[model samples]
Target: MAYKPPTRAGATVYVWSNYSLQERDRRWKAVRESGAKAGFDCIFVPLGDGIDARYLTQLRCSSVVLPTDGRPPIIIADRSSSNTWAPEPWQTSREWSEPMAEALLELGMERARIGVAGLKGGRVSHVTSIDGVVNHGAFAAVMRRLPNARFEEATDILGFARYIKSAEEIASMRKAVEIAEAGLAELAAAARSGVDAAALYARVMARMLELGAEYFPWALTLGMSDGSDAKRFTDPPLGRRLKANSLAQTEMIAVFGTQIAEEDQAVLLGPIPEAWKPVVARQREIFDEGVKLLTPGRSCAELLEFSKSVAEKGGMKAKVRLVGRGAGDDGPVIGAMTQPDALKELTVEKNTLWLWRPTVTGADGKTRFTWGGTVLVTEKDGELLSKRAHGAISVA
Candidate 1:
């Protein structure tokens, strides 16, 4: 089916989840505020076991999820709340979707009829035991009951709307960045030449926690001098100690309440890598090109095209899809790098705040680098949120 924007532009959106009630509500509130800013009339959230109603009561929108009634236009069985409501009926995520499909059938929404909005996964194979296979099972179940029901994946709609950052969202991310950066800065000072990678990560985690972050932003990658081991980016810490002059790549994902925030930085403990100078320069150039392209009226595709030119000019061949994305409720979707096949086109809009980190491999095939910052889109240009000194390397 061709992608369609949501018809419930101003209708109430319900968010369901099985995580910490406080965290789930926080995410729901973030969306609620974003929805209101984008002209949504109401964003409803169902209260479940362990949910604190008094806390969610502060929001202006209709924040309550009512018990299911056999009625049309009433979306039942959100991805997260189905099993909570009917344990036995929802043996797995797939079963949970049936209730919504049943509800849609009762509501008169039928196959290809349209006017229904729901969430789905990136791929059916990737669906977990908890969320049943994306929206297909639920959509199919609903359609099977009522042949006229029309339903579209709500993920794209909500994700596209969330593409732009809000003040509250920005504050949440900034808090994460601040805490993470401070941890990195402190780690830099406390880092001894012989400290093990795991130990250093522990220090970072401790310092970040001290600074009030909800969790550690993961570990830093100790890049090999040969660059042959760049694959180590995803490898777990070997508990290897920091060599006096080894190159290290530091990227972090800090949690704020429930939101995930990320930042990346590189450092040379004792002696700067001979190849780092050019790599750092090229990374900075990429950052400039990316920031320049983030202006209003630019599509994310266009900005990525510009990044490709900058990368080619700098002689790097790595595929750097998007430097950044919307970092709010979800980590990846709301954040950077809208794929070409992405359901929604990332049209840069006014009041949109983005975090971009365009990366490139240095001329010396051995050196890899990345850099950028958070920016808010204004009527004229993008505003910087994470203040940094010149270039991608903030050498203290």
Candidate 2:
């Protein structure tokens, strides 16, 4: 259903999310000091990736702002003929642009200042259009509708707003971390000689679902390293089998509600190699050192430099994939896979979530070892979210 934009005298901000209605409400509250009531005249909900009319309806019904005449802000959404669910009378099933134009015109906002999602550095996923596509068409359509309207990219507004986690968001992330730990435990238990990558992946996925995980960002990636002088990683779990006396490297992410927890583990199918022991120890040390520095107000650049120092002191070359990243919604990524200077300006803040991953290249150059888990930044220190031990899990 569509409504004319309100005659309210504040700028309208359009945004979307894959999170629940309650989470979206919290985000809206963060976006404006007056909260949802005076934040904007309307919100544009996108239809895609499990977001449907029912979900939008719930958002509208629950997002009532009592201070403002007890009326909720107008919610606009689009529907297509291909939508499997029946459209609510209050929702617009027309191609997204048409309804957006109507709403703007009705609100007498044909020539007003507006903030669209992804105007800055935010993600387009926050503003998907009909047909589940996020592209220039939606923005172009709105431009056509309100030619005189001044549009601005408001990406960082939402990014910084979501930087700190609410108590509810933290709780969801904690549960998500627990679920990920369970999945890792399952992987460790099932990792052994003669087991194929696919089988191990299946086992962990089943356990995660059984433990109430709703969704996962990516499939489990499992590979084998035989202490050879060669870099190795694998494609999606195929039929590759774990060999005796080899290390099984596994990466998995588990989700609860929309929060995510990531775990990367190395399991030894047999005896650990003498050559690999020092490599593993140094990787652990680097991770520990980095974790200790995850205190509030610490610059990501500082932490990265410290991490590099730790690796250098151990006579290893650091190939940092991710020092960490914002964990809840669209990530305000930190660190670098290639450039060390990336995200140097962003500092750690309390109540923020991150995945601290550090990888080190051995003296041999070809051998690389890596490991880490999700962490929550507190006022004093960063709390490790995953329950598993940091080093390689040895399964004899």
Candidate 3:
């Protein structure tokens, strides 16, 4: 998909997350409806852990509380902040207490039903560290300030709506994927040509940012290991060499604006062993087949069962965490890795995005030869959003 520039009809554009004001209005309205369904008068998006608020306000870092009555929302931010393409329909406060409480009272929400995001949404929403991303002090102070108001943990108010990705969200994700693959290509080239582990990892990040990426969020691995053990190094890759019989791999998470795209690449340090050839081919088939099943209207239970069935036939481990897990900012919002039951009820919806990595392990359970890329769910099937070659790269 090609990237489209968002337009505002002669309005002051707030350099927000590449979304138009009309899109913002569409999202807030959706949140308002979601809140109404939850019997809440408003939804509170807290500081530091307020992804939902950022989703609503489109501000860089959002402290937003949305009301269901169509009244203006509340935002807390640094007054000195500049060059922000902030929203128009919201009021602001300096912090989440005192002034925040006053704003709530003035809006006639002093004793109203307020839904708090991230309170307990660890299992369901983008509320991660997934256990409670809300700040206790900020929420507690507001509780003391509005003792009469009823505040409930309501991550779903936003979670439900977030699962349904808009067209604009998909476009941003495509851009993020573009940025990630550019960096991944660099790593692949450097690996074959003999690059230092530290220098290789550093260069991949540098390349991604140079290509207009917002952040290189987390995760990196560059080590020569003979087995399937994903050796996570705390020490820098100072002397790690990309020599024979070893692998240099990384599951890169590249960011563009608020969207993230992930892809795993491994450069083989030696020739392919004879015993691993069949396993590699079979896993590739399984991965390609499975991606097609990631279609709209498919139940999670059905997909889980499908993976399990194929894993049995192919002698692969049907691990949920490793096989398929997602619905990131672009899809599957209620995926609780701890709770499998919720996933059973999750129906695959269009425009949801996830990281699907299918690995082929040999007898030693180490040597995983496979491919991974961010998949975008469409009406027909899963779309691999990467331009990288679809298999493990082996160098003589």
**Could you tell me the lDDT of residue 167 within candidate 3?**
83
lDDT of 2 by residue, 1-396 (tens): 245332333222222223555665565555543223334333333222122122323222111111112334344433211111212322443345565566556655566555443333343122223132224675577678778876554444445665677777688788878888888788787777887767777777889988877645444434445545223343335647777756665567777655667778777777666666778787887787777888899876676666555556456776544433333334444444324444546788898888777777677765567787888898899888878666777788
The reply for model 1, stretches above 4 Å from the true place, is: 1-148, 216-219, 226-236, 257-259, 314-324, 327-345, 390-396
Model 3 lDDT tens row, 15-53: 336677777777888989989888899888776565666
Residue pairs whose backbone atoms clash in candidate 3: 14-85, 122-130, 228-366, 228-367, 327-331, 327-332
TM-score of model number 3? 0.85
lDDT of 1 by residue, 70-165 (tens): 111132322233322232221112243345444433333343333222233321111112242233543455446556433333333344444545
Clashes of 1: 18
Model 2 segments more than 4 A misplaced: 1-25, 34-71, 77-94, 123-133, 217-223, 227-236, 321-329, 336-345
lDDT of 2 at 257: 50
> How big is the positional error of residue 128 in model 3, measured in Å on the Cα after superposition?
4.4
TM-score head-to-head 2 vs 3, winner: 3
On a 0 to 1 TM-score scale, where does candidate 2 land against the true structure?
0.76
Clashing pairs in 2: 1-90, 1-91, 1-92, 119-153, 120-153
